[model samples]
Target: MIADSEIELHASRLMVMQAAWKHERGEDIRHESSICKVFVAEAVNRIIDRAVQMCGALGVSADTPLEHFYREARAFRIYDGPSEVHRMVIARDVLRSGNRS
Candidate 1:
């Protein structure tokens, strides 16, 4: 699970980098940014959840920062446009472009 989460994190980072590159070139990155927001938000939540699970009860305790991290990660999914909304944006863009790939 940890290995899978690491791969997901790396993939999310690459997506953000690609979006940043497009932005640097003065191209509109609305679609790319939406993808990044949804992916990275989920990736972070998954990674943090794994950490909390590994730490067992201590992970939820106030003695560590895991709880705080988990809470923030959960909020990340909702604040920057919910994942469902972003997914709809992505789907609409793809359908409008007629690009299945």
Candidate 2:
């Protein structure tokens, strides 16, 4: 779970950097940020869920920090951008790229 979350975090940072670079190169980045944030949040949430499940009841007990982690993970999904919004950005980007051919 840690590995998955780390990978997601790295991917998100890379996407953000790519968007900024594209903006600097005169390409539109309005969608990239939205997509990146959504993907990252989703990935992290999944990872956290798995981690919580693996830890069993302790993962949710107040005696452990996992509960706090779980709460933060749930909250993150609502921030930046939601999963649906990101999916739309990705779909639009794909359609616009004309790579479907």
User: Which residue runs of candidate 2 sit more than 4 Å off their true CA positions?
Assistant: 1-3, 20-27
Q: How do the residues 1-101 of candidate 1 rate in per-residue lDDT, one tens digit apiece?
A: 78988899899989999999999999989999999999999999999999999889999999899999999889889997999999999999999989933
TM-score of each: 0.94, 0.68
Candidate 2: minimum summed lDDT over ten consecutive residues — where?
Answer: 76-85
Each model's lDDT comes to 0.92, 0.76
- Best model per TM-score: 1
Stretches of candidate 1 exceeding 4 Å from the true structure: none
Worst-scoring 10-residue span by lDDT in model 1: 92-101
RMSD of model 2, in Å?
Answer: 3.1
